[model samples]
Target chain A: MREGTGLPAVDLGTTEMLEPGTALLIPTETSGYQEDIGLFRAETGSYYALDDECPHEVASLSEGWIEGEEIECPLHSSRFCLPDGRVLCLPAVRDARTHRIEVREDRVLLYPGTAATRT
Target chain B: MSIESILVIGGGLAGFTVAQNLRARGYAGALSIIDPAGIPYDRPPLSKAYLLGQKDTAGIALAPAEWYAEHRVELIRGTVRKLDTEYLGVELADGRRVHADRLVLATGGSPRPLPIPGGDLETVLALRNKEDADVLREKTTPGMRLVIVGAGLIGAEVASSARTLGAEVTLIDPVDPPLVPAVGQALARRLHAMHLDAGITLVHGTPVDISKTTHGHSLILDDGRSIDCDEVLVGIGIVPNTALAQAAGLETENGMLVDENQRTSNPLIYAVGDMARTRNPDGSLERRGEHWEYAMNTGATAAAAILEQELPVHGASWFWSDRHGTHVEGVGDMNGVGATVLRLAGEDPIAAFHLAEDGRMLGAASIDGGLTIRAARRIIDRGIIVPPESLADPGIALKKLAR
Candidate 1:
């Protein structure tokens, strides 16, 4: 059973959450687009979720490496700032879609319908 | 002194970026870009996506047409015949002299011509602008025999696209390994193998002459072999458009001389992009950078300099090319910079990092490993020291080393 904190939530299994500095690619449906979402756990315990696809080549961003607040796509050096999903480098011209995330009762919950929370 | 009016001579990526960045930086001055091309679009896709019909012309626009009007940046489609340095203006071919308080030169570069007889034949072509690309798209057909004169990024990608379009491509270069100087030996070998796997004919020979035939042209090689093709694309290199700078009495050698701040001999005038040979931050001479990132970087630096703001520091020089459906990006000094090469671990895709003796990352080249190269950029920029064993490990996230 999953508990929703006033938003649509998808239970990612309590013990299966990725560690900090790592990301997980979880398929989810958004209001505008339906695709896999990349959920990242920062070193500070905060969570961020963005579209899994890199806009430049449509490569999976879940395989990307995350720095302070940026995600570098694995296929090409296209980078984007987290939370707001602002483009930080070239080869990728569009911004990734950032979704809302929350940890509800030891389980990772992703709210895909919420508006993007800008950093 | 305030810059009330700014005129950018060139409407390519460099020119377009400067205009947009100036406005983004809150400059209320009148900005105008003058160039021979009507619409300013990106050029990277001309050899890959656009040529292969994967991307259309509209996909390459830097900014929508309405963006210029909204930003109040005037876009003029015209060619400049002369640069009037005294009045800080440009003389157009139509006898119009447009003056500005400040002038920025972004006249990128022109394709180098093949030094051989019959090189300018109708069937022979070179891709530099949209017109050249359009001509190539028209001639790219199935069963067509295409011969490329160089094995640089442009020629290699063009071969990839031509192969995708069902054309038989033959790439001829004087060097044994074409991309060794740019991407090191290992990655260059991979690319060479990739091209061969895609059925592209690789020939190691210097082109001596081009003879026109009834069907097409025959390219004669110094090795006493002739390659017959329906079309010839000479992607040897580029020659910077420094004539305007030379005529304006600005110092010019390999290119128009400029400082790290993109400042030319005259403080009122500035030159950036492929046409400008920039000086290092410490006043050392640097050759002109032909990469698109260099154009954008110099454009932003010039805008910041005009606003009297602090100049941004450039990190590792980066460039990327697509071949045989694989995207390869090279960052920093791929000449190895006397550093040891370490291949990073990944199965689907791989990357090679160049680490200096002091444990500082010097450069990286990757196939489908753009993230590693992006992380490697910060390591090289910050001079971060990481153990070679750690860099080779797949478990260790390279970005964490930046801290």
Candidate 2:
């Protein structure tokens, strides 16, 4: 509920409305998703990670929003999985590197192995 | 010890530019930037392209990692809680304290929140930070109704983005044509056409009184008509984040009062961007300046202040908005513009300008004027006054002022 602009970060851990069994695929700051860096808040604590860059074309995955573990590219409807980096839709076939995460005190700390997530 | 290390508080355009220009100006020093827990990102697009899904945060990356390392700027990830002027340091929310020889409080402004009825939870949203945009984005369904409570630049940009996202947008404003506070009524009226043509419901001359309804809330207009809405967006104004500087005993008004050099009451600390209620040639202090370029230019001015270098005289303010496929620009302060002039590439595609009664031109807004905008900006920024005839003849360059 912050006035967060650009892909601002929303920690799923911060809200109670996020129910279990459903997953939230959030964008990390490493990807530079501007406003709410998509927060993946799974009530079950099960989450998925993917490159915010859409493998198809140049559309940023951060622009493309998340539905379940599948994130829809905002430009084209290129869908990809948060876990295991698989493309479920067309125009995007490359798998994005899964960002390593450690839930530190309910806050997700992203470990960029190469620290090369563009944004 | 000489001020060699700089800690810039706030990673918006100003903060980033201060760091960027420091490198560009050949000043090498230990640099650190503290923002609220996100990679440094550009914000102008949040109200437009980002909102329209045209771009994401990555698209507007100001500095990549290589740039940061090459420039030697450490990116501190959090909000600044307290600034110890005596210690020449800042305390971040994460409990990490950093010290610098000089501190630049670029802690821009926050969105002005409404304190009126129906302003409680489940009904309202503000577009300031990265999270707020996502909140609105998540809530906006294909047919979700959005009532935009203001018709200013940010509000209008959000309106355009919402409409593009397939949401039904209703912009309610008490002012006629909107943007009168920034751009005068004449230019505001012309821009109004662009909004209406983009499928937005424009309610003018009517103040909306928000009240709780069975479903979310309702904005009851002064005309006695009520519109049911899924959510309310108030972009009416902004509140400067002057508390940080104020807490440290720096002069503060509606914004942190600063001199033309961007030096605040304490010369040891400098303030830039909107947070600095900078003095004008007219002897008045500007509480706010909402342009991206102004932030960049002002940052450079503050850097000059830090270096004790001669600074450039203030130029005409320039700003742009890309909403609903239209790119509108204003050169010079639109606040003083009075007389109106409409230009056209052809008989159909048009743009407009405004000037005061004394023929002192004030503002300009163009729609797809292309490079013509480049020419117009030069004319306005350099104070080149063009005659009415040259405007009609597109062949002449906008710089021919004396003739």
Candidate 3:
């Protein structure tokens, strides 16, 4: 058994639901959190998670375009690095909050309220 | 010569971006921003979120006080009397002189006054800065009759926001549906029709005169129609503030003339933001960009030029406006001569794209289609030749074509 971080890990369905270079939103009710969570799969077949809300406005990051390891906010074009949620552009000075995601044998699991382990 | 200290006039987005980019690029020399407004805040929200009471003064600030202190950027609150180019310094209105090795002019534009009778009335309002928005917000009350002239971006946004505040808004414009040049005719028509749905009365006429009335004001139109309202807002456009540049012997034609690097006629001085117009190598002046993104882009370019670093490359021009609970974004040249392809969903225009004869995407505009616009920007930047059928088909996601 893997050592637990005390927080509940949510199975976000199968990895097949999220193809390479695509993203999906985990609603607040499903994530058991107040804010929605965005799970993105880069073209390199890596998974990263972040708060769905763009730090600049009320836009959902899940709807944003994903290029490489950065996600460009649909509104105002503010880009955030997927791994650490660092702001890569202007109009948004604050960095977004990132969450941890793990793909355990084709099953995607989300550790809500936990910081993403930097790769 | 190495730049030891830099001074920027006008603490708007352009000036703030210059300072911000300078620090980000590791230029640790002395930097300062001087403006009549003490702190730099965003202006786009002034006619929308800030006016609607959704955001406070602190919310619109470009950066917090701590950021300025941490970055060691001095924020000076003063008005510039004149530019002492010989000494590479500025003379404040209070008789104080601040010297710097390099000078940047980001003095943005001022609201263009209506050129008609009683147009300059004290009660006639214009939204440019925070104080203007605060005053407009205070006057915008429930059931108050408000008449806004010029249904452009700012006027339309204010009308929508005022209606949300329960005010009776009447918007006036010369054109049937304004902003055809910015967002194309189809998208502009869709956006303009939203005013009626939101309970804003649209008036297609020019105001010939504005007279003070007992109850409020009477705006006389060229068609001999008069609109009586408690308050009036004129948002036609802005006149670039080029007086300082003209007095300092810099090239000024409608705006301060600058090269591709944002450098003015005088090598020691540079200008950015709305006040600076690019003069091509052939001596033709390009249209001055007055949008927020253009200001930020020019500031970044100016910072790099000042530090002798490689200039940052910016893509096509982009702008966005919010009204009637809908977000409209457009990128590149929407007015280019080409065929227009519109993507509609159940009779509503979700996105409209312009394509050249060779199928190259020229420009695109969309309502509540942020993802579509983002993809369109990439397609335009990369010069992607997408078929018209795929662009018009709502079933086919634009993101796929962008790849």
lDDT of 3 by residue, B180-221 (tens): 988888889999999999999999999999988998999999
User: Candidate 1 or 2, higher lDDT?
Assistant: 1
lDDT of 3: 0.91
Error of 1 at B64 (Å): 2.1
Native contacts retained, all candidates in order: 0.38, 0.00, 0.62
Superposed Cα deviation of residue A29, candidate 2 (Å)? 41
- What tens-digit string does per-residue lDDT give for candidate 2 at B175-268? 7777655545555677778888988998874544677677666877767898888888988778889888888888888887788888877877
For each candidate, how many residue pairs have backbone atoms clashing (under 3 Å)?
A: 0, 31, 0
**Between prediction 1 and prediction 3, which has the larger DockQ?**
3
Q: Write the per-residue lDDT of candidate 1 for residues B23-140, one digit (tens) a residue.
A: 9889998999998886688899999878877777677777668878999999888999999988889999999999999999999898888878877666679999888998998898
Model 3 scores a TM of 0.97
Q: Tell me the docking grade of candidate 3.
A: medium
Better of 2 and 3 by DockQ: 3
| Candidate 2 accuracy as lDDT | 0.68
List DockQ, one per candidate, in order. 0.37, 0.02, 0.64
